[model samples]
Target: MQKKTDFYFTYPPNLQELDLATMVSMYRDRGEPRKAAPGKYLACAVTHKLLKEAKWWFGLYYSQAAWDELLTKGSEGYPLTEAELNLLGLVLSSETPPHREYVEKNIGTLPKLAYLIVNDIKQFGFLQEDEHGYLRITPRGERALQGISRRIYQKRFTAEMLVVYHESEELHRDDDQRNDQATLF
Candidate 1:
């Protein structure tokens, strides 16, 4: 009835560390996604925001690159399908901000899975699509992305350093102590 895992468990990268407000503003400024069916637009908007930020962090300046990378990187946990990638591509590249018609024509029908991605990010304080479809990234998101990665890297590096340090230190353990142990034997 249960299973045991030998590997360590890790939490999903904190969503609170990304930049959400700027992302939402990018959507409004671009003026696209104005047309995905009513409730769907907001969810799309929030998902787009998080994806873009992740791409930026990953060194992808364009949404197309970001979408590809996001989907690839997220596959292990949050798998994104073709339809979702299409929607994200539209939102990320929204120059005139394509409405529902534009998205449908470009990406075909939207799927329900997109909502799960948005909701997952929101659970960690990424953003919530309002009734009007607006989104805002929480401060936690900014810190999580900007700060957590570096901190985690440092922590791992430090652990490794400590191992080396301890090993090196062991080499210097008092020779007299060794002699004493040998004599007892």
Candidate 2:
């Protein structure tokens, strides 16, 4: 007679518990992307968030006339003293001619302008102070100015927000599709 062999099954004591934990872990991990492109995602997120906040500020008060005057008449690359910006902001904010006249009177006086600049416009990042205690527009400031100008002139600021969000979504989708296709092979 031919010899017969019998097989016996064995299981780990915690097999069920281990399997459950592994599955839960896998499901949780699968929700997040294994590899996300650097900078692009972060840039998109920040741009979207900031643009939304910026829209409100742009609408509420952006001194177009003052901005135009500064850009066109003021000296480029030369530091615009904090005093100068304070006077400009004051003049722009004034609704009545009398108020504007009063603010304009302080334009030439350094002390008045000094106090106004220290209290108000100095906090903005676009204007940076140099060792000489003078403030100038940074490259970031220039870009911000241009963006605000465009938004004001074009009347498409809200639409631009949607465009940015959609473009980022499309880029992310494309990356996912590419990843999926690569895995298929």
Report lDDT per candidate.
0.35, 0.35
> Model 2: which ten-residue window has the lowest total lDDT?
1-10
lDDT of 1: 0.35
RMSD of 1: 21.1
lDDT of 2 by residue, 1-185 (tens): 11121111111223234444553453233212222244332111212321211111111211223223323212242224323433443333334322333443444343333344333333545445555544444554444433432333332122222322345578999999999999999
Regions of model 2 farther than 4 Å from truth: 1-122, 155-185
lDDT of 1 at 70: 32
Output the TM-score of candidate 1: 0.24
Q: Which model scores highest in lDDT?
A: 1
- Point out where model 1 deviates above 4 Å: 1-71, 96-106, 110-131, 134-185
**Predicted candidate 1 versus true structure: per-residue lDDT over 75-98, tens digit per residue:** 332323333334444443345434
Model 1's number of clashes is: 15
Per-model TM values vs. the true structure: 0.24, 0.22
